[model samples]
Target: MLARSLEARGAEDRTDCVSFPRIELRLGKQRYWPQVLTCKLFRWPDLRHLSQLKRLCICGRCGRSPADSITVCCDPYHFSRLCEPETPPPPYSRLSPSNHWKTIDEPTEHDTARQLRRNEPSNSQNQDWPDSSALPSVTRDEHWCSVAYWEYRTRVGRLYTVCEPSVSIFCDLPRGTGFCLAHLHADGRHEMVRRTRGKIGGGILLSKEGDGVWAYNRSEHPVFASSPTLVRGHARGLTVHKVLPGYSLKVFDYQRAQALQRAMGPELPDGPFDPHSVRISFAKGWGPSYSRQFITSCPCWLEILLNNC
Candidate 1:
């Protein structure tokens, strides 16, 4: 049997319908080995030898971008830091079924008051912030919020919220445990795509008091907190603001309740210097390009969206 086969691949399949091949990546060290594999294969030619070992070099791996692999979950998604020049968004007819562009619920004075009362002083481990579990249930708590998933307009001025139901539900989660994030696919499904370990992991906790949320700098490095907010007036969309790490930020105050600490995790282990490969292979293309896959585990909000509430 043929171990693997090649098919027509590009940004799209041979027929050009979305084709997201499941990158059957068994982590051999690099963090996002799968998606990074796809990028190295289909996207670019910028990967040095894994750990700069000249014996197992690129001549054995370079330009070998495979097309077909394990059956995929859905179509591939292209994430660009650069927002595409505004284009017309999909009309209502072509839009996904779960999308709704609703304004985020802002905390009223009364709600904030209630949250403060519910979070009355106690023998909490962190005195500055109350325990997340002490607050009332989701239906009753003002601070019970989830990360809202939105599909923003690429060409037009609009954002469609597909899934925002269950991210921040921490009832079953362990107090100190951390979970990872997934990409909220356009089809109302989620696929794991980001990192969730090291200094920071998966998501943060929102304390009911002050409509407040606390982020931990679990990583040794500094992380910038980022939240997606609605632009004032007719803009009818979201913009992100970066908040520094080791602090608390107001939730419900932004379009999305969660934020991401923008740091690319601990550095990849610098392998023993192999002079032959260090001078040629590692120097040839993208040098040590692991951190670029994602800044944090699951990009925060999207990570929560993919969770079981």
Candidate 2:
């Protein structure tokens, strides 16, 4: 039966439609279709039945259901298994911030004193740091309900505000998408974002659904995301997630951020820390799992600064 099926053109021959005879074989208490059994015997040894696979007509033309004169093709090459890519595990185990801090080697007292002394400025040296009081205050525009804004860092930095509920960012879109950045000037540092012209299919789509923000990956290459709300319960170390093409992930949760803010209290840390900010890299990932330690090391990336979250 296997030899005859192999020799038979099946659907490969464009002129005529060849159909394999329906045969059922029983082994112990199990019954199997001849076509499915043949497929498992030669091509996919692990494939169970037609339910786990999709059949494609090799002749390049066939409808979902054939007419009375047309026959179904049973060629093993015409079938493909349906499956999704597995997500990689986080870099660190379930260790809280305090516990994770304890794992690191503490600095020596002398080293700490030396570092403090090095940071301290001398009276004779003129301070290069800009005075906070001298800078003008920025106020938000009341015209639109701004949820978030993207900060792009290329040869020169540019900011694009998101006033609408949903927005699409792309390099080159023929239809003139939500926020087209193709005409924007860039240098060698922004080459990765510029390469999405004709090579990659589409760009990312961000939508404000309910209290959370969702990011849909429509591009050919995967997008990497790192958000405070997404890594709430995890360790202090950065956690970067790889979002595959045609997949959507909830990048930010407003309720979770509020709860986290309440737990943290009014006292803020001396170091720069923004609980509502999110970072996404295009076509590249950075974190403990990857060679790049920080998102700044990525070629093309977006910094999403959220408001009133």
Candidate 3:
């Protein structure tokens, strides 16, 4: 009865009208009907028809409104189920090893405020050092700050902020413990100041703990007397004596490295060297390739060894 009804609907005249045969024929040649359909439906659909099918999906992880015509939650793992079998994975995994994993060795959580350690040698180790009164104070205070997960950008295409840490909200975080210094762009110069907080982790500013009674030093980084702004009911600013020595090299080490390289010439390797590898591998097997005379003297080459430790 169904066949008769289909036949009566024009029988021979409607033979070409049957879409399944045409689809099978195209598919026999490995043609992608569903992809063609999707591209037609999405990329070139009439605006009136397109508007009816368009939808906005929010990412479960990020709460972002993805493109109107695309499936929002189509994770790479589930792509096979999202469309007909012919569609391949999105040609790229943003998290793939070749791309994002190349620089995974470096840390994203850069403590910009950390200073160099005082005990570490600023000059050669054998040289006589100045007394405690003669040497300068290298300490700096840490302040607490955490960004909400929603606040961080999805992708950073630029150099500086490319490796920034992901932020998340923590309700039960510890109160009044951890602190790190951050350099904020103010006035003309990058001034160093100490800040404290009621909460330990996460990047939110709080108020100063005490009244505006802080000491000033003649030889240290300029101390600021003003109070920082607050978030919630907490004070984010406190007076810290010194940041670690690691933070100290962040400012001036690059310039010093370039100067040392020019003076040493090709006698030393052009850049930082792995001292442990030189000590273990080169000391045993390779001689001319990794020589001892060049390895010990170069400070820039030596520091990478120190940094590795």
**lDDT (0 to 1) per candidate:** 0.23, 0.47, 0.18
Give me candidate 3's TM-score against the actual structure.
0.14
Candidate 3 overall lDDT versus native: 0.18
Top candidate, metric TM-score? 2
Indicate the TM-score of model 1.
Answer: 0.24
Per-residue lDDT for 203 in model 2? 57
Winning candidate number (lDDT): 2
Better of 1 and 3 by TM-score: 1
Higher-ranked by lDDT: 1 or 3: 1
RMSD (Å) per prediction: 22.3, 16.8, 26.9
| Model 1 ranges with Cα > 4 A deviation | 1-175, 178-203, 210-218, 221-236, 254-309
lDDT of 2 by residue, 258-285 (tens): 7767876886322235556666677766
Task: Quote the RMSD, in angstroms, for model 2.
Answer: 16.8
How big is the positional error of residue 115 in model 3, measured in Å on the Cα after superposition? 18
Candidate 1, residues 114-207, lDDT tens digits: the string is 2222421100000122222122234422323333221211111112222311222111222322222222233423223122122233233223
